[model samples]
Target: MSLPRARFDQFRLAMMLLTRLPVGRISGAVPAMDKARWAFPLVGLVIGGIGWGVFAAAVTFGLSSVIAAILALLATALATGGMHFDGLADFADGWGGGSDRARTLEIMRDSRIGSYGVLALILFSALLAAGISEVASATAFLLAGVGSRLAMLLALVFMPPARADGLGRMAAGKGEASLIAGTLVCAVLVILAGTTGAFALIGAGLAMIVIGHSATRRIGGQTGDVLGAIQLASETAIWIFLATSAH
Candidate 1:
C-alpha cells in the first residue's frame, strides 16, 4: 500500500478503537495496531473538544459552574460511549479485590460491577469533575483531554503486558516510533494553546509513567484495563495541574 493510504487506514482504525466516533467501516487488514496507536491523541482531541464545547455552551446559557462542569464531563463520556470509564471500573474491582494476578484478570473479565468498581468510578469521576470545574476553560479541557490519550499511547508503547495474549499485546512491542509521532502531535496541540499547556502535558506524561510502573509491579504488565486506568490518572493529573496553576 502507498504510505499515505497506510497512515489513513491506521487513523481509521485508531478512531474505531479509541472512540465512538463514526469512523464508518474499517477496510482491509489492520495495519499494525501499534502503528495506529499514534493517532489515539486525535481521538482524544475530539473527546476534549466535545467537553469544551458543551461547557462553553452551558456557561453561555448561564448554568452554574458546577452544572457546566458536569455537562462537559458528560459530553466526553457520551462521545466515547463511556468505554474508558467501564475499563476503569473493571480495573478497580480487579485490582482492589483480587489476591493474585490470575484472580485479578478473572475479576476484570466479569461484567458485574463490584463495590470496589463503584467506589473507584465515583472517586475518579469526582476528581475529574473538580478539575473541570476549577480549570473552567476550554483550553484546559482540550489540553487535558489530548494529554491523557497521549499518556495512554506512551504507556502502550513502553509498558509490557501481564498476559501472554490480549489487545494490549497487539498494540505493544514497537511503540517507540509511535510514541515519538504521538508526542510531536501532542506538543503541537499543547504549545499552540500556550506554554502552560506544555507544562501540563509534561505533568500528564509523568503521571502516566508513574501509574504504568505501578501497574507493571502490581499485575506484571499492561492490559487494556491498565491503559484505561492510566488515561484516567493522566487526565486527572492534567486537571489538577491546571487547577493549581490556572490562577
Candidate 2:
C-alpha cells in the first residue's frame, strides 16, 4: 500500500479499537495494533475535543467548574465506552487480590470487580475530576487526553506483554514507526502548552516508568488492563501537574 493509504488504514484501526465512535470500515485487511499505534494520539484528540466541548458548554450554561469537569469526564467516558476505566479496575483487582502472577492474570480475566478495583476507580476518578476542575483549560484537557495515550503507546513499545495472547501481545513489536510518529504528534501538541507542557511531560513520563516497572515486577509484563491503568494514572498526573503549574 502507499504511505498515505497505509496511514489512513492505521488510523481507522486505531479509531475502531480505541473509541466507540463509528468511523467506517477499513478498505482491506486489518492492520496490526503496532501499525495503528501512530494514530492513538489522534484518537485522543477526538476524545479531548468532546470533553472540552462538553466542559465549555456546561460552563457557558453557568455550571460550576466542578460540575463541568464531571460532565466533561462523562462525555469522554461515553466516547471511549469506559474501556480505560474498566482496564484500571481489572488491573487493580488482579494486582491487589492475587498472590502470584498466574493468579493475578486469572483474576484480571474474571468479569467481576473486587474491593481493590472499587477503591482504584474511586481514587483515580476523584483525582481526575479534581484536577480537571482546578486547571479547566482546553489545552490542559487536550494534553491530558493526548499525552496519556502517548504514554500508553510508550508503555506498549517498551514493555513486554505479560500474556502470549490478547491486546498487549498484539500491540507489541513492529512499533518503531509508531514510536516515531506518535512522538512527533505528541511533541507538537506539548509545544502548545509551554512550561506547563514540560511539567506534564515529566509527570506523565515518570508515571509510565513507574507503572512499567511495577507491571514488569508483578505480572512479568504488560497487559491490556495495565495499559489502561497506565493511561488513567498518566492522565491524572498530567492534569495535576497542570493544576499546580497553571498561572
TM-score of each: 0.92, 0.96
Once fitted onto the true fold, the runs of candidate 2 whose alpha carbons sit more than 4 angstroms away are none
Indicate which candidate wins on lDDT: 2
The 10 consecutive residues of candidate 2 with the worst lDDT sum are: 173-182
lDDT of 1: 0.81
Each prediction's whole-model lDDT (CA):
0.81, 0.88
Candidate 2 local lDDT, 119-158, one digit each (tens)? 9999999988999998877777778888899899888888
* TM-score of candidate 1 to 2 decimals: 0.92
lDDT of 1 by residue, 2-67 (tens): 899888898888888877779777577777787788888877777888898999999999998788
| Candidate 2: C-alpha lDDT | 0.88
- Which candidate has the highest TM-score of all? 2
